[model samples]
Target: MTSAPARTERSRTDGPAEPHRRRRMALALAAGGLVLGVGAIVTLAVWNDSEFATGTFGAGSFDLQGSTDGAAFTSDAAAPGKTLTFTLDADTLAPDDVVYAPFAVQLSDTSTNEAAVTIENVIGGTIGDDLTYSLFIEDDFGATCSAATPPAGAEVVADRAADATGTVDVFDLTAAGEPVSLCFVVTAGAIGQGEAGTITWEFAGTSGDTLP
Candidate 1:
């Protein structure tokens, strides 16, 4: 009779605790699933990442021209390994005769640099002290050289230097299609006639980008 009375009421209170524990377990499982979903989305976004870009680079060119009496020859372009040569009009000379050799220097179409004119070589036969020359630069705007005004002196050669290498800073050819003017004065010094000589102008172009 005692054992039958105890077994009757023990089963009823355990029902509510079982359902509460089941609800807490369901909420934890749902939160863990949401966290996993968020992690998957973040992993996908990181896997699909990217970057950007830009351009390229190149080099420049240098070229020049030498002219006498309106005829021009480009350096390294007119002929292979050939320098431009011009003849001076010192064919006839007398004592105290100052001859003006008007000439022009031009930078080629592809030239993008400043240039210098050097007296590279000067040779003569038997002029003695009669054939002396002076180099000058002109500020004339005309394409052809003008003799109306006196030229600005840059270098003077009293006698032919066997190694004549001197530079004259003429007008710079920083822009394209622009040219410079030069002049040489061969003065027959105090000596006898029947003399002849030759002068060579070496125009060397230097890039503006490499200038000091």
Candidate 2:
């Protein structure tokens, strides 16, 4: 009876300790999750603060200057029906009397493109019938028509066959004052003339995208 009396009920506190431990573990997990969420929110705010700022993008001229016998043309305006008239100024134009009339066509540096030059629609005067003329172009390129050497190029622009057109290679102008020369060596014909002869004609310069 004495041995059995010592067996008292020991209340096991260890059983309840497990639930407290689980509660502590759950609280630690929740604390860790909260910390991660706060860190993620901070990272998101920092990333969202970055921003990016707002962003922003003509023709050339083709002009020409023309002259006759070293004198500038009356008007540089070029169009249909426009003409340059060269009149015989000598008191008497005898046979073999050669007159060298130096003419020039200038292209300004402001012109962005090369021009195609042409002479057309030559209407001769009554005196022109009795006279014959030869046209020559200087090979030496410059602005001045006054060249020291005689023009050697034998190109006939006017003769018994009066109506003839002449053309130059599409070329760029030297400068504003500089020009290519077109020399007319007009000679009196063997046939005698009645009145003062005249040569009335026009020249045209056109520029476009066409290439040589």
Candidate 3:
């Protein structure tokens, strides 16, 4: 008899496409993981550079000294400074009488700049009305300051009454101990009988000394 043909068994090639799709997905996941690892490594890497800076500072000095005699110098930085070694009878002044005194000034060796000196005022005297004075600055070095006369190069600073107020004159001094010599000549102005007192003159000095 004519029997029916036996059914052929299903083969692997004839199965559903699900297994192929799963294999492709696994490969894609593996590639994504590799890319993530490379990105993390790049983020962790770093580069660096730098620089630095720094400074120093200091202060300067200034000091003034005086000499009553032209030889020995000292500081008289207070009111009623060094007493004058007058060449006349200063304690017994009379009409038309004249007296002389010498003084000196310099910047201390420790000073950093040159100086300017001014006659700020004259004070403390009842006899001032009858006393007129003159100040002279001399360029004569190594010579004794004298009341008889200043050096030929001497210049008069002021010829004011002893009680004159305000700035009357100005002078200069070199830096680091160069001395400027001065002579004072005071004259009596019709002084009264038995009228007497003392006077104080102010000598103010400053840095960058100049003359006018």
Candidate 3 regions off by >4 Å? 1-53, 139-151, 209-212
lDDT of 1 at 190: 61
Each model's C-alpha lDDT? 0.55, 0.56, 0.73
lDDT of 2 by residue, 1-212 (tens): 34555666647965688789999999999999999999886743343456787653046556677665444533456443333333444436776665556666776646666666665434355556655555666654322222345566546364432334455332445344467667665666664655564654455667754222
Number of the top-ranking candidate, with TM-score as the measure:
3
RMSD of each: 7.9, 8.3, 4.8
Per-candidate TM vs. native?
Answer: 0.52, 0.49, 0.74
Weakest 10 consecutive residues, lDDT, candidate 2?
140-149
Give one digit per residue, the lDDT tens place, for model 1 in 1-212.
Answer: 44555455656777798889999999999999999999887743335666888778766665676555445544543222343222334566667666666666676677545555344444445563345556566665222222455455444333443334556444456655566666666566665555554544555556665322
Encode model 3's per-residue lDDT on 1-212: one tens digit a residue. Answer: 99999999878886766777888899899999999988888856579988877667665656778887677888877778888877778878888888877778887778776667777646564777888787777665324345455445455565688776777546766667777888777888888887877767667766773222
On the 0 to 100 scale, the lDDT of residue 107 in model 2 is: 64
Ranking by TM-score: 3, 1, 2
